[model samples]
Each structure stands twice: as C-alpha cells, then as structure tokens.
Target: MRRKQDKNIENKQREEETIPKKISYAEILELKKPDERKLFLRKTFLLIGLILFVLSIILFVFINTLVGLGLFLLSIWVISKYWTLQDHLLRESVYFHPKYQEFRETPTKKIQFFNFSFSRFIATVIMISLIIWNINTFGLELGHVGDTGHWWNLGALTWAYPLAIPLAILSLGLVGYIVIHPNLTIIYESENLYHIYEIRLFSPWLTEIPKNNIEAIRLHNSKNGPQWLYAVILFYIILLFKSGIALIEHPFQTNYIHSVHLIITASLTLLSIIILIAKQHCYFEIVTSDRLYEMWFDPALLHKRKMENIANFFCIEPIARDQHGFFDPLPKKSVNYDDQTRELLISTSRSYFRLCFGLFLIFIGIYSIFSYSLLGEFTAYTCLSYGFIVFFKGIKEDFSDKNNIIIEIDRENKQFKQKRIFSRILEYHFFNNLKSLQLHENTDKSPQYYPPKLDIFDIAGVIAIIFFIVQEYVYQIMVWAPKNIDFQNILVMLFELSIIITLIYLIIRPVDTINVGTKTIDNYIIQLPSLFRYSEKNGERNNFILSNVYKSKETKSFIKKRIILIIITISISAIIAVIDIFQFLP
Candidate 1:
C-alpha cells in the first residue's frame, strides 16, 4: 500500500510538470503564428479612419465648419489608434522569448557603445525633439485663422492639411521604426567550425560547412554605408535649393521675412554638406567566412584578429583614405577580419567618378537654362548616337561567347551533364527531362552566337532614323513645297515628331539583360547551367556560351565602351555648343 501510494504521488507530479510544459509549448506556437487579434484591431481602426475622413470631406462640403472640424479630429484619432495597433503588432512579432536566447550567449564585453541602451535613448530624444519642432511650425498651419494665433487664408488647407500632416507623421514614424529594428548579425564562431546567424527577430540558426565552402573572407569597406549619408544630404540640399529658387521667383506674399528665409536656407545647406561628409568616413565592414558584416565606425574593427585552435584563418583589412581632397574622407576606421582577403580598395576611385558625374550634370543643366535651343539640338543628337553605339556593343559582346564547357544540374533526378558547346543555339536537358538551356562561352575555336537581328527600322527606331533623315527634307519642303504649308509650321511639326519618337524609343529600350529559368510541373524538377567561361583550348578567342555570358572580358570591355561613349557624347555636345555659340555671335 505504501509503494502504490508513492507511485501515485510520483505520477501526479509528472502529470503536473507535463501540463505546464505542454501549455508553454502551445503559447510559443501561438506566438510564432502571427498575432491575428492585433492585425484585426489594426484593420478595424484603419477602416474607421478612412470612413471618418471621407465623411469629414462630405460634411465640410455640405454641413457647417464645426461638424467638419469635429469629424476631422475624430479621423485623426482613429488613424493614430490604427498606427499604434500596427506598431504593437510589429513589436510583438520582432520580440519573442526565443530571440533573447542569442543575447544570453554573446559576451556582454564585446557589445559596442552605440549598441547600448543609453545610445538608443539619446537617439530617440533627438528624433523626438526634431518631430516636436516640425509639428510646432507645420502643424499650426493646419488650423484655421486665429485657431492657433496663426492667420492663413489658403482655401486649399482643408484638403492639403489633412493629407500633408498624416504623410509627415507616417514618414517620421517609418524612420523611427527602421532605426529601432534590429538587423540580422552573422558571427563566425571559429571554434565551432560553423557560421552563426543571429536573426534579429528570431533565435540564431547555425550552419556547418567544410572550409571549401568559403571562397574568401575579407574585411572591405561597405560601398553603401558611407556614401548613403552623402547621397541623402545632397538630395535634400538639391530639393531645398530648388524650393528656395521657386520661392524667390514667386515670393510668397506672407508675413514671413524672405530675407530671413534666404539666410536660413543658405546656412542649412552649408551645414548639411559638412555633416554629410563627416558621416561618410565612419563606415567599414567586418567580413566573415560566410557573409559580409558591416561594422560602422565601431571599435570592433580595431580588435586584433583572433585565431583559435579550431578555426585557423588570415584577415585582410581594406582601408581607404582621402588624398588630394578628391572626396570627403570616411571617418578614421578599421575592422577585425578572420581568415579573409581584401579584394579591392575602391573608395577614392568611386568618389572621384561620382563627383565628376554630378558636376557634369550640373554644368549641363546650367548650359541648358542659358542656351536652350543649341543645347537641346546637341543633346538630341548625342543621345541618338549613344543609343546606337550601345545597341551595337551589346550585340558584339553577346556574340563573342561561343565555345565553352556547360554544366547542367538536374535537381530532381540528381544527375549532371557536361557538354562542349560550338554554337550559340546549344541546348541541354535536365535528368528530369526538363529543357535546361544556357549560352556557352565564346572561344576562338567556335562560331559565336550573334544576337537575334533587330530590325534597324523597328517602329520607334524607324521614327528616330526617319526624323534625322527627314529634318533636311522638312527644311527643304518649307522652301519648295506648296504655299499652304507654312515654313515655320513644317519645321515645328518635324521637331515635335522627332522628340516624340526619341522619347518612345528611350522609354521602351531594355536597360539590362533578362535571365530565364525552367521548372517542372511538380516544382521538384529544376535545372540550370553554371556561368559561361572561355575554354583555354579555344585559341583564346571569345564566343558566347550560355554559362560564360556574364564572366567574359567582352562584357567588361562592353561596359568600358559604354562609359567611354558617354564621355565622347559629352565632348561632342561641348564642341557642338561652341560651334553654335560662334554662329550666334554678332
């Protein structure tokens, strides 16, 4: 009886433990499946907001101002509720119990200063201050005259205020959301011989692979990070300058002092440029065996490379410094690398190119503003010539990859086929019998696959070609044709026709190449060939094979040609401008 009683107690305890475990597992599952209740609440609020906004507009048109104002306020409340609910849903989705596991294992000592709670608090405070200032200045404009001690007699405020205020609020919210959201961080645990992917919103996933899987691991400067700040600043300055110019031309007949505005605008632009340059230099990447890790102006880059008994690798640190003031220097920075090689240092070269292009565009805009007719004619001719050059170059490179090895993999049948290609029209079949095709590389020994012949006078191209051909004809007709046709009228019609044709062709031309893939009905069968490459045995001549199409030097040469063509086009335009100016001289 004692033994039975002890067994029963043990069973009861086990049952109690199992019940909680099952309940906890169920809760986790529910969390994983997206919170539908929050979504539904958000949808309800959105619908209510939309209805209120529409009703407010109708009430404003038919009823009194008080009813319209009340409805508008109600709409705003509904919209705010919708946004709050949506944000709550995102937070719930991104912050689950499982996600905290990653932080638990990572050493607290390695955490960067910027990643701390204090840094986030400071950023949030600054953002909030900016928001408050913007609202005080712009939100007051939404109210009626004397509503907020501001008098504005713009009748468009009824619609504009509602739309613009919400847009501004949404924009600010999006920026905050992006800043707060955690990004996926991949860490190389050399000791484990595996890659650790700490997904920002989820538990870490680990993948183990042989050393051969890693092609190279190197610390290179992030192309996007530093330049993004400058791009944003430049874009903002350009917009502001354009706005200021417009305002100066058509002075806003308001109480605001125009002189004060001009001074403010100039100061803002100067400050923005300086801040933009400062931010550009503080970005670097911490590359690992499997993925590129961007470590932005962080101290992690300064740490010495550590190699453990388990994972042995070298680190390559790629650094770029500003010399000769070609462009703004990125903030002084370095990042630790583990078993990686730096491929190239590109900061200075890319900056120089970007600066030159921007200045060229600005010069063109200025010239166009001053001498519209001459610049217009020269621009038209230059664009036409460049388009033809690109079309021919694309064809030439496409035809160059003819003889190379093609490896086609059939996933379904677990079979692979290797073939030597001699022509551009070669085809391969996957083991699952799906038609897998690729263009082989062009080589010296094989005939190249020429691009499909495009009709030189295809509808739009015909129009462009005819426009230039008939321009002289139109000029002649104006002098020799019937009295009913006015000379200037004919010339104008010809110009308009040419412009329309050129615009249509420019709009329709494919800016980049297209890739095609084939899948079986079951979706289990998939096949594709590896990239094309030149065969050493083929006398080093280039031909186009499906696999080697993009890897060829011909492709690089083509890109170089396009760039050179652009330079030549610009030079030609300048020369034409000089000639035109000389003709116009008294």
Candidate 2:
C-alpha cells in the first residue's frame, strides 16, 4: 500500500512538471540570427585584407626583395580570415537553431575541416623550417655531385651521396605536404549531424567517425601535456635544430662535441618525426562499446556549454554509476601490531606501479650523471622524488600499527579521546554529538568509483607543476652553462627538494577518521554520541567511529556566507573583464 501511494505521488509530480514544446522537423532545420561579434569580425577581416594588399604593393615598389617576401604570408592570412568567416556563418545557420536538439546530431560538430588550430599552424611552421634547413644542408650536394660535371672532382664525397639522395627526397615530400595541407579543411555539416575532416599534413590522418555511430563522449583535461614519448621528441627536436644551425653556419670549425651533438640530434629528429607522423592527438574520445574515435581541439572550444550542447544533440548522457556498491556504510579494516595481519590492515592496498617508475627514474638519473647529461639528471630527480612518495604510501599502509589512530572511550569521564597519526596530542571530546552518517553523491568525468581525496591529490598536483618548472630551468642552465650554478638555480633546486620532503610526510601521515557527527558543541546534544551516552547512562559501553565527512552547523553557515560573497565578487569581476575586452576589440 505504501509503495502504491509513493508511485501515485511520483506520477502526480511528473504531470505537474512543465512540458517542453513539441519540436517540428521544419523548426529543427531553421537557422538562428548571426552572432554580432562574428559579423563585425568578418567585415573587419575584409577591410584588413584591402589595406594589407595596398600596403604590400607600396612596400614592394619602395623596398626590393626582403619586404616583398612578406606579401606571401599576408595573402595566406587574408585567405585564412575568409575561411574563418565562412565557418562562423555555417555555425550560425545550423547550430544556433532552437529545435536543433531534436535532430540528434553527434559531436565533431565541424564548422570547417580546413580550419587551422594553433597546433596545426605551429606544426606547419616547423615543417617549413625543417625543409629549409634540409635544403641548406644537403640539397645542393645531391643535385650536382656527379662524375661528368664540374663536381666530377668531388668524387671523394661519393660515399655520402647515397644517403643524401633519400634525405633530399624526404625533404621534398614534406614541402609538398605543406602545399596541400590548406586544401583538407572542407566544411561538412547539416541540421542533423556534423563532423570535422581528419587532416594529416605532418601526422597520420584519423579515420572519419560518423555522428550516428558514437555511443558515448569522454572528457579530458585540456591542459594535460602530450605523451611522454612526444615530450622526449620535442626535446630532441630542439637539440637537433640548434646543432644543425651551428653546422650549417661553420661546418669545418665545429668541435668534436658539436659534431657528436649534430649526429645524435639528426638521428633523434628522424625518429621523432616518424613518431609525429604515426601519432595523432588523443583528445576528445568518441567511444562506442567496440571502438574509439580520438581528435584534438583548441582548449577554448571545449567549454562546458559547448559540451552540454553536443550531449543534447547526440541523445547521449554522461556515464555515472555506483559501480563500487558502497551504498551501505561499512567499517574499514583496523590495523593491529602483528605483521601476520598485514593483509587485513587496510581496505585497499596502494599499488607499487609509481614506486617502480620512480626506481626506473633513479636509474635514469644515475646514468645521466655518469654520462654528464643534464636533461637526464632533471628527469631522474623528478621521477625519483615522485617514486619515493608512492613507495612510502604503500609502506605506511602496510606497516601502520593500532596506535596510529587511538579511539579511547572514557566512560567515567563521559568523554572520548581521539588521536590520529599526525596529531601532537589526543583530542578530548564530550559525548553528546548528534546526526547520522551522510555521504555525498560523487561524480567524476573519468570512470572512477569514488571521489579522490582532495587534500593529497591537490598537493601532489602542485608539486608536479613545481618540479616541471624546475626541470625546465635545469635544462636551460645545462644548455647555457654546464658547470656554473647561479644563486637562483640553487634556490629553485632547494624548493623542489623541499616539496619532495613535504610529499613524503603527507603520504606517510596516518588518515584519521570517525563515523560520528562533524557538528560543533551546539549541535552535539542532537548527535549519535548523545544517543550512545543514553546506553552509557544505563551502565553499558559501546565504542563507535564517526564519519568525518559532514561540516558543523557553524562551519557550514560561515562557508555559505563566504561562498555568496565570492560569487558576487566573481560576477562583478567577470562583467568588468568582458567590458574591457569588448572595448579593445575593433
């Protein structure tokens, strides 16, 4: 009877909810108004082209070759603007429709396939630069070094001719790619679906993923760095470019160290280029149960609003589930003095994967120091530091004794004495704490069962960032001055080391938890401890742990007030920022 009554209540509530208007097919296909800012940008671009063309002509007439070459870049910029404007118009026509959600379009929502991202532009520039370098280095020798020509006496250089020929051919191919790269950005979109064309100017082209086929959308941190191999590739590329330039400028005067550097650089650069050609950026992954589709995007484009818009059209939803089945509260395993009970000491054992990685890093560091490779030293220090942290985390969980957390039920004193691992002394608390255990619903973007503990995760993340900065600085110093150490460098190294120590302390610190009220003294009378005291008053003893998840009334109230103030401050700041940006825009 109660279940039936609840069903009736739910049905009534559903009926009372506001109904969305039924969308028609025609309405779904209808376009909305053009964005005012985009329209203004379109006109401004056209005006700039006219001005630049006239300016280019004047410069060509006044100055000779140097300034005339600038026109080529100016023309590309003008054409790129027209392409961008075309994309903005397409988005306005299809995406802005109010009823477009009814069409169920999949993501990739391509405005233009030919549209260039910042990374793409950077890649194109790198390719062009490399082609020029190759030409300067090997082009002339391979083209004219034959037995019948004035280069007939250059037969002594014949040993390198075979290798140079293939190298020159590869350079020519790279140049050809740049010429054709611009043509790949085709626009493909409709009211129902849209997709970006996967173009490979320097990298492998991704296969097209149809909108109707995608079963789910996965989000990633836009700021996450590229793969470790890719990072190594970038580092080597820099080294190669520097050495190659030095060789080209003064081939005969270069030292043995410079020669070795050039050879190593060239080999690494070739390997890196091959990797770049084979690897595609694994950004937004469109997942079906059976397959995955990966694509990269500008970080600014992956806004929450845009993601939600995509989700609405695709008829897809974010995956969130209680996969761990922690719905019921259970006591975590208690640690004891005996090593025989180590297996039951903690609910979960922290994996040693990171610790192993750290050890590998230490090996790399030792090798680097022996080889006098500064970059290797940086990698070693950073990795070893992180490795020891996770190693100790495992150690603490494995070896922690009962004294790590002491929960004393003092019946005569009508108090509880709680001592956690990191605390200097025990905290004395009166019994009479109230409220039942409460667990907040946790949802993460990744496929995780539980929310991460923010304290540890947040600190580790900050340390990683600091180490990255330190690593970069160390690399810079090694390149500029191998032996000299500046005061600033010493300070940075110290700071980096200090963070490692802090990480070790945090990782090994015993986690203290209880299953009672997180309330203050005022709400203590209404808490579960107060109810437990009733049994104590009747000459019975019950020992229990409290859940430390809830905030006290006073704390919650204070936090609420502060949050309101912060929201208002942020609102005012955002409005001011927007106005300032608009004022500077033409």
Candidate 3:
C-alpha cells in the first residue's frame, strides 16, 4: 500500500521530479523552541541558578528595603528580556511519521553507534571522582549525629541526615541511570526517507527532518582565545611551581609525593594546559532548513568508513575549511542558475557557557558587595570591575562579527545576496566584480609570550630596568639586614621582578593580521579575525584559502608609544649592573 503525502511534502518532492508517500498534514511544522541564544542551561544547571538568584534577591531586599524593590523589578525585567536561564526544548511524548515499515522498504538501513558504549559512564565517573577528591582536599568538621562524634571526610553527609543523605542518594540514582543508558542515536534510512531517534539526558524526544530539507553539513574547529593568553598561563604555572619549591628550600622532595588541595589544583591546571595543547576544533554540523544538529567529535578518532557512509547516504558533500581554516573556492563557470538561486545557509551559533557564568558572577558579586563589603570603600577603589569585564566577554561570543547568515549566489546573473536575520543586515555584491579579489590569509608563527598591545621588546626593557633598580637597593642595603629579612626580601624582590617581566612580556607579543580588501576599491580592509573561510559555492567549493586563528596588529599600537618606559627602565638597569660589577658605587 502507498502512503498519502501532505501538500508541502508533495510539492517539495514534485519539484525534484519525485513523489513521496503522502501524510495528513501538508507542511512539517517546526515547534517553537526556547531562546537558547542568550542564556545557558543543561540538566541540573537551571535549578542551581534559580537557588542562587533567589538568595541574591533576598540579601538585597532585606538590606536596601525601598531601593531593593526597584532593583528587584529591574532584575526581573533584565532576566526576562535577555538572560533568563531556561531548560532545553522538551519535545512531545509521541510523534507522527511514516509508518514503521522497516522490512518493506528497499535498502532499509539502520545506522547508529556501532554498539552500546560505557564511554559516557566512564567519563561521568571520572568527573564525579574529581569532584569528591577536591571536596576532601581541605579539612572540614561536619556536626555530630546525636551523641556520635563529628563526621569526617565522606562521612560529612551524615550531618544533614534528613536532606543531605536523601539528596545524595537521589543523585546516585540519577548517575546510575545515566551510566546505564548513556546517549544513543538510531537513524533508520532508505533511498527516500530518514528517521532519526536521539536518546540523551537533555534531548529525550525523538524526531526526524524531511530528507530534502537538509541544507548543508559544515565542519568547524572549537578554537578559542588569543595566543598571548595561552602563553601567559603556561609561564605563570611554571613560575608558581618554582616559587613553591623555593618556599620549602629544605629537603622535602617527597612531602607532597603534597596537599590534596594542591594536587587537585595542579590536576585542574594540568587539564587546562592539555586543553591548550589539544584545541578540539572538529565538530560536524548538520544544518536543516529550520533546525541544526551537531556532533562534537575528534576528527582523528572518527571512523573513516562511517564518515564515508554518512556522506554517501546524504547524497551531499561535507564542507570544511583547510587546516589553516580557509575554504577552497569555486570556478567562474558555476552551476547554471536558470530561474533558481542556490541558497546557502550559514550558522554562527556559539557555546553559551561563558555567558551564563558571567551572569552568575554578576549576581554573586552584587550579593557579596551589598551584604558584606562596604559600598564606600568598593566605590573608591573600583577594583571589582572584573565582573563586568567577564560579562562583556561572555556576550562577545554571541554578538561576534559573523552572525548567522543566509546567502544567495546567482552566478547566472553575476549577483550575490547576503542577509543576517538577527542583525537585520543585508548586502548585495557581484561575482564578476569579486573576480580580482583574492582571499587574504595570514598566520603567525608559534604562540609567544605576550600580547601585541604594545612592542614586546619595549616591555622587556622596562622589566629589566625595574629589576635592576629593586636589586640595587637590596644589594646596597642587605649588608646590615638580618638573615631572615635578607631571605624574605630576596623572595619579595624576585616576586616583584616576575610581575614586571610579565608586564613587558605581554607588551611585546607578535600580532599577525588577516583582511579582506579589493584592489579595485578604495583603502578598504575588513579584518577577518573571526572569519574562517569564504567561497562562492560554500557546499561544493573547489578553489581554496583558510586560517585557523589570527591576531591583528590593528590594536597593538593603541597607546602608540612605550619608548619612555622602555628607555628609562632599561638604561637605569644597565647602568646599575655595570656600576655594581666594577664596584664603582659603595
């Protein structure tokens, strides 16, 4: 028996010169989803955020009374308007689709995980183990249970026997369920249709997209912040380790074979360093007409046969940038547009973890300042502006240079149309006019020590001068100082030296540039710091150019001059070193 086709589905099939089994509903209606762009939430995060938010409101209201009322209303407005954390879209319990005639269809294939896996279970266990390890890193005294002595270590759960133990037990149940099930995906497919079923903690509902509705599949690297920051962190960790060893100058090599807390902190730092080294940028992105599906995986570990199967099954090519993050372009004689304009849909959605963290920090900072710290003292120093800085950084991920885009390339008409929905930006260009435009790509050498905010050498000179100055005073005066003072002062002086060294190290970092400009146009260059690649035919591109990451010289000379600081610090240091060596000064 033949299935009935809906109007919208029928029309799509008819255009492609093929007919599909009909359905009662004409068009596949996409359910309205949560505004996931602004806020962040996963399984248990929303509850935690809600509790923190309530606590903050209570503290403010109790203290400010009248003013707190207005602040509360403002908070409500702000949260609702922008960053109100919400849960993932929970799909309906059931769905309507083509009948389950798996045996009847030709070449009916069911593809998913090669087998059930405990990878997720293992990862979850490791994460929870780390959490418990850190929890016990510091000393704690849990209150006594009846006449019993204080609970120690893992026994701390007994203090809150009523709620804590119950909650812990409930958490264990959830973890057990997750460990058993993990996340599963099953895609049932034939020559004409694809039915996808995803079983995840957050994505429990199963559904499918129309086969013809699939627009494109893109591959992206999860590259992060500037190189300078990475270098700084690496050096800082090394310096800290050195400092710790210096603190225990005695024979204590095996003491910490160290604190559990120090071990925990070191483990976290090492994890961060490992992330810095292995930048996991490979995510296979599948964009449908109305929705997007993503699989974040390490490309190196992805099965080659499976990847080929996906490509062959979809009847489409996967678009990815070259290692440098550029794309191969298309030729002049592109597909005949006829009466059709090949439309390209591009996504600019980013991870929202930072944005959520920033908002949470703002709430915590406000509560801390209002409840405990003096408003007058805080206002005077203004040192707590970091919360705002983090907030801005978080938002930057969303409102970056490249917004979600829809492009129509009419090579037949030699025309191009670009539009961004959220930004309401529209532009028109011509392919012929762009013929002379070469894709401009530039990359820097390996990451170095400092940012390109200023000249790196100048910063170095300044540090040198400051170090000599601090040392000269110590050398000249330490003759009369006690042994303890001398030792302590030397440590303090080295500490001061490290700070200056970092300051200059940051100033002198290299900054390469990437830009898009036309020789035919005026002095116009749009920096492509955030742009990975551009091509006329995005899906089936041929000619190519790309970059992974690039820092610009544009912001390097913001202050324009570091000469005075460099010259003064360097000259003073050099003169003192020379004089001391020659014993020219007493």
- lDDT of the structure predicted as candidate 1: 0.36
Q: Rate the local accuracy (lDDT) of all candidates.
A: 0.36, 0.38, 0.39
lDDT of 1 at 8: 100
lDDT of 1 by residue, 285-330 (tens): 2222333333343222222122111112222221223344322211
- Of models 1 and 2, which has the larger TM-score? 1
What are the per-residue Cα lDDT tens digits for candidate 3 across 57-107? 886767666565665565555445333333222222223233442211233
* True lDDT of residue 455, candidate 2: 38
Instruction: Give each model a TM-score.
Output: 0.34, 0.28, 0.35
Worst lDDT 10-window in candidate 2: 525-534
